[model samples]
Target chain A: MRFTLADSRLLRESVNIISELVTEVTFKVSKSGIDLLAIDPANVAMVDFKLTPAAFTEFETEKDMDLSVNLENLKAILKRSKPEDTIIVSLDKDKNRLTIDLTGSGKRTFNLSLIDYDREQQKLPNLKFNAKITVPASKLDDAIADMGIVSDSVALIASNTNFTMKAEGNLSDAKVDFPACDDTVISLGKEEEVMAKYAIEYLAKMARGSKLADEVSLSFANDYPLRVEYNVQGKLHLGFVLAPRVSND
Target chain B: MRFTLADSRLLRESVNIISELVTEVTFKVSKSGIDLLAIDPANVAMVDFKLTPAAFTEFETEKDMDLSVNLENLKAILKRSKPEDTIIVSLDKDKNRLTIDLTGSGKRTFNLSLIDYDREQQKLPNLKFNAKITVPASKLDDAIADMGIVSDSVALIASNTNFTMKAEGNLSDAKVDFPACDDTVISLGKEEEVMAKYAIEYLAKMARGSKLADEVSLSFANDYPLRVEYNVQGKLHLGFVLAPRVSND
Candidate 1:
């Protein structure tokens, strides 16, 4: 399998977000695109990432293949790429390595050894969410960072008229409220007012996708895992599901 | 003692450079300016940093005093400052703390506890140098960074017609030469060619001062320690002395 990306920013961004949760992931490549579904080691979070052929300038594959990759190693190689660089990725079956070449002002190549992963692929869970909210990615990211400054966990509350993120600490408490009429709120729905708490660390890692997308969609049911997604129209899609942290109070 | 700086970039830059070599330093504050001279624990490098009253927008001091501080803590506070923020630094003698307030869109203050450093003050050494070269700080910084990619140490050679920096590793070698007529070479003087090798790590830290100065001056004699100096006209001055690494060859 071989593919070339005119802009590698999206690929790098997606890999960075997933690598923070899972160190190793199996990338399934086919004529359609590249897909990765992975659950973090602690089983507290899951990531669903997909890149279609439309997202790449040139993509080709003789046969479908599963390539187990060390996400950290791939991220390191991608970090060396410049904004104008075009990245080419190919599998070296004989050497059992993946070759990546970045071409821009200069061409730099990195050969990374592939690993054999034995874990079963994680299947996406079918979830029925009561509340869904779509907002600007920057707004969500900033809210999460503000909450992080106050506490290690934040509670997301969705009501008929508003959505809010709140965090409380020993010395400070922060809350960001977004009404349905707010420009940042693209859409909002609620069967009933729903509230759930999640670890801020995971949310922050997922929020990194804000750099790639202008808006993010969030969906969740009362006390259920939260789904954060960034979709670039028809080009690419990245989503993460984080488990709720049960609060004693 | 109290002072307000129109811009905090210089202070942040100075603290960052000093923290890389020493964790703690004693800052001597007087009516004229603030001065610091300290040697690393390994005695491989020494830093002499001074900021004149002219560097600050408002400066006032009732008496001269010595404030020992943890550079890491200070750096963390400075990292929070925005580019347009006005930095106000004041000593809380009653609490034995340093209060740094950054005022801009919003005011944020950090109260850092002062430590009692017991090390003896490092005095500046007076030595005659046979060669001196003044060049654009960016030019020198780029050369050192490029050399660092290939070797652990770099050789500085000053000749009558050219000044050069060279580094060699097992697989690769890099050299940057500046002819006397080059715009980067502000000035070069030498009775004979003088060469010395120093650890790249320390040189890289010193090079960080480039962000605060347009040009940097280098002075050394034979195999003696190299002195890297950044003088911002009359506002601020930062200098570093790095002992040469003895070559086995």
Candidate 2:
């Protein structure tokens, strides 16, 4: 398998988001695109990522294959790349190595050994949600960070008129209200008021995808896992599902 | 003592440079300015910093005083300041605390307790040097960082024609040369060739002052400690003396 990317930033951003949740992942490569579905070790979050051939300047595949990758090692290699660098990735099947070539001011190639893991692939869960909200990615990221200063968990509440993120600690509490008429709220739908508490750490990790897109879509039900999706330049899509924290209150 | 700074960045930068060498420092405050002379625990380096009353927008002092400070604690408080924020510092001598007020979007104050150290003040050594080189601070910083990738110690060589920094490791070696004609070298003065090896870690710490000044003056003898001086905006002067490493060659 061989592929070339015109811009290396998308891959870097995708890997950054994935690394936040899991250290290792398996990539499914086909003629159409590359796909990844991984659940974190704690089983608290799931990541679904896809990059189409259009995302790359060139794409070639002899046959479909699953390759296990260490996200940290890949991130280290990607960190060496410049913004204008073009990246070429090819697999040496016989040698069980992946060769990554970065071309910019100079051309450098890194050979990373492949790892074989005997683990079953995670299947995406089917769930129904009562509320959905689309907002600017930065707004959500800021709210999450701000609320994080007050509490370890944040409550997401969606009503007919507004959506709010609230966090309360022993001495401090923060709340960010997003009304339906606010410019930050692209769309908000709810049949009734739905509220759920989620771990701030997981939400912050998911928010790392904000680097990939200007807007993010969020969907969830009352007391259910939250779903976050970021569409990158119409070519790549990154999604995360985080289990809600079971609160006593 | 009371003082207000138009911008807090200068103080922050000064503390950053000092903290790189010593965790604890003593600040001598008087009507003229604030002064600090500290030697690192390892006795390998010394930092001398002075900020005149001209550097502060408002300066007031009733009497001369020496205050022992924990640099890391002070740095943590400074890191919260925004570029546009005005900082006000006042001493509560009766309470043995220093109150720092940051006024920007909002007003936040932090009161740090003063520590009493029984250590005596360190006297600056009177030494003579045979060579002096003036160069861009960033140029030297880059050269040090680049050479750091190759070895733990670097050799500084100064001749009438050029100044060079070289580092050699077991497998790799790197060298950066700044001839008299190079833009990075403002001036080079030496009657004869002089070379000395110094610990790269200490040099890197001193290079933190590069952020405060465009150019830095380096002076040393054939086998003596190196002196680094950074004059900031003609108002603050930061200097460091680093002991040379004993080399077998």
Highest lDDT among the candidates is held by which one? 1
Taking all chains together, each candidate's TM-score versus the true structure is: 0.57, 0.55
Q: In model 1, state the lDDT of residue A19.
A: 94
Could you tell me the C-alpha RMSD of candidate 1 in Å?
Answer: 9.2
Per-residue CA lDDT of model 1 for A114-228, tens digit only, reads: 9999796579999878788888897788678767765799899888778888776543345667777655452334355888999999999999899889989899877889999
| Candidate 2 clash pair list | none
Worst lDDT 10-window in candidate 1 chain A: A182-191
Screening candidate 1 with a backbone cut-off below 3 angstroms (N, C-alpha, C), the clashing residue pairs are none
Mark the regions of model 2 whose C-alpha exceeds 4 Å error after superposition. Answer: A1-249, B182-191
Q: What is the TM-score of chain A alone in each candidate?
A: 0.95, 0.96
True contacts kept of 1: 0.00
DockQ of 2: 0.03
B132-235: candidate 2 lDDT, tens digit per residue: 88888999999999999999999999888788999999999999998876554434444578888999999998987889988898888777899999998757
